[model samples]
Target: MAGTRVPTLQPSFDELSEPLRETTFVVVDLETTGGSARTERITEIGAVKVRGGQVLGEFATLVDPGRSIPPNITILTGITNAMVVGAPRIDSVLPSFLEFSRNCVLVAHNAGFDMGFLRAACQRLGLPWPAPRVIDTVRLARSALSKDEAPSVRLGALAPLLGATVRPDHRALTDARATVDVLHALFERLGAVGVQSMDELVHAQRRVSTAQRRKRHLAQGLPAAPGVYLFRGAKDEVLYVGTSKNLRQRVRSYFGRSEQRRRIRHMVTLAERVDHVVCAHSLEAQVREQRLIAAHQPRYNRRSKQPHRGWWVVLTSEAFPRLSVVPAQSPQLGRTANPLGPFWSRAAALEAVDALHSAVRIRRCTQRIRRHDPDGTACALAELGKCGAPCAGLESVTDYAAHVMQVTGMVAGSNDDVLTGLHQRVVQLGSAGRFDDAATARDRLAALASVLHRGQRLAALCGIAELVAARPDGSGGWEFSVIRHGRLAGAGVARRGVAPMPIVHLLQASAETVRPAAGPLPAASAEETSTILAWLDQPGTRLVSSTQPWSLPARAAGRWQPFVDAAAVARGSLSGADLRRHAVTG
Candidate 1:
């Protein structure tokens, strides 16, 4: 089997038809005159055809590179100009090599480099160069061997580490045999490491190389320093938006894993380009990410704003600001007294108003009833004091209109002034010795304090958290959380057609509670707390607070505030001082 030329085993097609009993690989090595693709030539080619991971045959030949061999390369590979003066060139030998590589995964050390050279050579020779996939043993070895076992990943270093006996030869066929032996050793190691498929093996190599490169890059500089990283698909669509304290490091993680690299490879193959924006602060990067996510709606972003639905309407023309539900129609301002909806549906609007009526006194019947039926008593709700006595025709429409105004003002959340006025009334009651009414006012203040206290939770998390209350259909409510930096923060959805006041307070509470820990924030140079606060102050940004709870429609009450401070408490970062500062006492 050694020098006497073990006859090349060429099994008949029928014998080869049985399912392979072992894994099969084709081991190959090329000896070239130089490294440059333009000037180099394959002076010697060697391959061992394997079946079921067993070497079946070996092919070896010397090729006339057509150009004179470099003196240094001749010294290195021991294939001199005289040696291949009359040998068949690559054009003549490529046909047999392709046939040998047929139906098998090609194996080599640094396989891509070798394949690149082979493809270039084949292209030059006008050969078809079959697009056969290949396996790289160098990559396999990186994951297989302990760092201390081999000084380098070179073929010479691997031969001894594998302990596969081979002649001390660098000639084409000898080197090919050694590589095949080394490859089998690597396959054994890979099997031990749970690698099973050709694709898995190749993918493992890609991950190893990528991870190594990433680690190297990180070591060269601070990874979490600050910046924006962009991921783009082959078609140049943004795939993901991320900001990091260390842009270099975070970007590398996406490319370092086999699964992630596979996705990136898919993207890169389709990608026409790449772009990135470096920022002075991570908050700025976050703002940009949100803006982009809203703008482009990239597929990878977690928080996508869907169109809002559900609305509440009140007719101003009616004396009591007749509350009603409206279906989602084209966007238009409410008719004078009739505020069109924020209701998800007419039914939801009815349910909401009913629930609010129970929580806070609001009349629901129309005045037109008692006007026409002056003799009959008012509707049942009117009898129950749930509706003004307009139905009984006892109360004038003008007087009925005052109660309706109260209902609308209470529901809109814009009546903070009213709440303050109510607080003043509580003081007045306390002075007048109206203990019960004073106690009720005190309770309301406590509720407001509870609402404001919720904002204390934001300090423990690592990122910016935002809560958005949206009606998916302009009627019903949906809640969302926007986590930026490294914290969890979210706000509850506001009921449709409610004044944006509660929503605004809710956002404020979310920000206060879920803000990242007061450590060095990511990309702090680009954005500050003031910047984020200013952005929050923008029009249409919603908030929530408990100050006007009873006045709020029931639909808006279900949305819960995200408590980020709980995490901070668990972490010991929310010290007594922090908690005291955040806690509100009535």
Candidate 2:
């Protein structure tokens, strides 16, 4: 026993401080009758289990494949039918090999080929296969050695380059032993890149950019919970804002294999720190993310930024009402006027305005006029009877005021007379063979219907000062949210066994009220209102309570019924180009 050292037992992979040195690895190689696992049979199986550079055990066997080995396979692996005639079948030999490689991570040059054969054998024999953690030396070598360092990553080339104790001779045992050496060589290379644990080694195989690797520290300390994360630059300015159900995994992914986008790669390089705001649930996280992106206008975010720039459809408060598209921050209007939309674009709002104008003879002139201003002149549209010519004082103020009332009633979703008039006009145009004009009218009707539907929905939500909603959280609990004036005010979780009344009350009491808008519209932007609507629409969500009343019409008040029928008729007769032109105009 003098001067002789005994091999020490390695620690379990989970408990090991240095898993690369302490975990057991079973390097495997197989010789088969052919390449396909489903069609071919294994002729030989070779595997060597090692830990801390010491051999724990070795498994090798000649398997009787019950079929003829191809000439080419015999020449390559030197495994012939005669040599395996008296050998044990795979079912007899597989149990011993499995025992030898138990509690070890399987390693192979091209693991799919070897593992596929073993799994097939297990399936054919009705044996339970222990699905071990696998590591492919091919992927490891590709990650460890660059193209210049090794022109070819093939096992035969890598075996000699890695200084293997025994060169691969196409035999299973020799190839398996060679692979073990290559695996060790890759571990050594991986250590230089700060990969020590088995998990780190596996993750290192992904091709990550140098900048992303350098910023890995920014992801540290991110909690594994639902939250919104902000990637801040060197000056602490937010570069990106995102939400995730699992903050730690999501943020860490930016430095790991999943981050392949070039823009995100560049963002990672600029990000100096990642800050997060934890949320009780994913819905809350999403709301917070949208709010943060809208507030900070992070450089990397493309959508939902500049919500204040949205457009609205408003009826001017003149003696003769005219619909117009105005910015969200438009100047104060007359007391008689009513605003309907926070539409995504001015063009979209204009489509709705044109729909109403075509049906009613409200003045289309843009100039502001006093009741009896004599200098006002009638535009050509007035001469053609398209307008009542209130500018030229051709129509009485009483008649114009009546038209204005009808327009206001339509916007308020209380009447559909204007829509009915537009539908009649569309039918007349189509019967007269003016298909293009008919198509235009149909498009305007659709635009108006869409805007009115959205406006009614948003107004109903905004009219509520306080509302509570809850839905199943998939964890034997309920997720609750509180809204104040169409904005998310608070959110929380309630367990299954406990009464949710207290939690609901707590959320309701904590909910913050948004400041009322000076105009008729809600202060919340379209994006904010949409976010709240989406949460409310989730399956199983129910209104627990509300302080203010809410009611949406069972159907829109506009001549929507006639418009629908007219659209159906127009669609059947109009050319595809005409229909598309109308759609694109909206």
Candidate 3:
């Protein structure tokens, strides 16, 4: 036993892979009435079944597309409308094709087109799509054959070179037969390059990098739990961070050919170790991932670079209050009466502020205003009668105080002056045939209403010191969350036989102590709090207990539904040209 090393048992992902020689390939081809999967219908289905180079059987059928074939498509595919007069419809034929291709890997030239039609048919017929393994001959040919050997990967071009007996002429059966020959030719080429398993054949179209293939060693013993995962480089720098419902399967996928992202592949290559944090629930995993991203700020993670860039509308505390849009965060939330939002855009926050301006003529300028105006002069807005002219002392402090009270009530989720004013203005504009002005007013209403709704909901939850919520975890157990100040303070699962209240108390005891932040998101980041709110809103969640009253806001955004829906519809209806115009103008 001297100078001997005992080997540690490391699980290999490839242990589950079956050999290619035993694998069945259903080389398929489809003739369609048109190119679009949504609009067009399948005209013909042809599949040749093969195992280890021996032909087992074939399934070929003409489908009644249920519509007239376009002349161009008919001319191209040679499948005339008259030819499919008595043919079975796709619904009638799908069951038989499903039976034939069962447990077989699908091979096709430009697989997306054929698979799109097939999957769409499954969806339209209210049948589940058996998500089968797919291999595209086009990609395979590109990988195996050089441009000098074959100028094009088209079936017509390669059928002769690959020694295919059947020539492709756009007919489904002929093309399907030709595809089988192409598949075998590519398989033989792949064999020389050491590809010999079902997994390898499926992935041979695009080879996974050597670094990716070798890095499976780093994925050993990853737990099958909801968690955050980190890929750390040799220098102990965190290269990337991500979360998954099944950490083991998700991390293993990174070392496989399915991971096609250039950045991810490079990250895997540079990765020296895989680190993970297992969480009791998805909410915890998500929050942890976000926190880790903020702490480490890994170069590969693109989303959370500027985590607190979301905009919030705040009211300045001064002689004459003005609406101030600040980035929603602790540091940015200075001297405001309950900041309004994480509005996603500065222009949208400004729009909401302007909506309030329309209702109460607050000063819309950044210039400092004194109670006693020394200049006694007005700006352009005041001259045009748009502003109350606080700088010019045209509006008294008492008058402005009343307007500021309405603004504060709105901010505290108690007033709807902005909503009422904007909605009525939209109605007035519509009646007067000022359609464009009405639409503008409607957009402002929607923006402000949405922000108010979210702010109110968040504030109600954040106001609570401790709240317990429970939902069935779908497997005879209760999933519980202890929320303190809008953030997920604690989360755990209680089995069926256990006393749930005892577990609830334990969760409360172990929960993170959240300090109230100055802004709407009191305990955690907006992203984390929003995710928790969504979890609690799921249909079956029950409020187990609460320390404080969690009541809804006084003025709900529900009354402004008409303008909100119209705004949504208008946004959805905007053409690409209109979108481009808006983007440029905004």
Please provide TM-scores, in order, for all candidate models, with all chains considered together: 0.38, 0.74, 0.70
- Candidate 1 C-alpha lDDT tens digits along 182-264: 87788687654334445345555654533333322222232333455656666668876667755544444443335454544
Instruction: Quote the positional error of residue 554 for candidate 1 in Å.
Output: 38
Q: Kindly provide the TM-score of model 2 when superposed on the true structure, using C-alpha atoms.
A: 0.74
Clashes of each: 65, 0, 0
Candidate 3 lDDT for residue 92: 92
Please list the residue runs of candidate 3 whose C-alpha ends up more than 4 Å from where it truly belongs after superposition: 1-205, 329-332, 372-375, 495-499, 574-586
- The per-model lDDT (C-alpha) reads 0.52, 0.78, 0.80
Q: Model 2 over residues 1-586: C-alpha lDDT tens digits? A: 0011112233332333347778899999999999998999999988999998889888888999999999999999888889999999887899888888888899999999999999998899898889998889898888778789899999999988988778998899989999988888888877765566776667776788777877877766777667899999999999999999878667767876567788988999999999998787877888788889989999988887886677776777665567777788777522324576767888887777777777778777788767775457888888788898877778877878888777777767777678778767777777777767877787777667767766777778878887888888786778888877787778887866767888787776666656766554455666777788888877888888888667865445433645555566656665676664443221
Arrange candidates, best TM-score first.
Answer: 2, 3, 1
Model 2 per-residue lDDT at 191 = 70
- Please give the lDDT score at residue 72 for candidate 2: 97
lDDT of 3 by residue, 195-216 (tens): 5677666666775666676687
TM-score of 3: 0.70
| Ordering by lDDT | 3, 2, 1
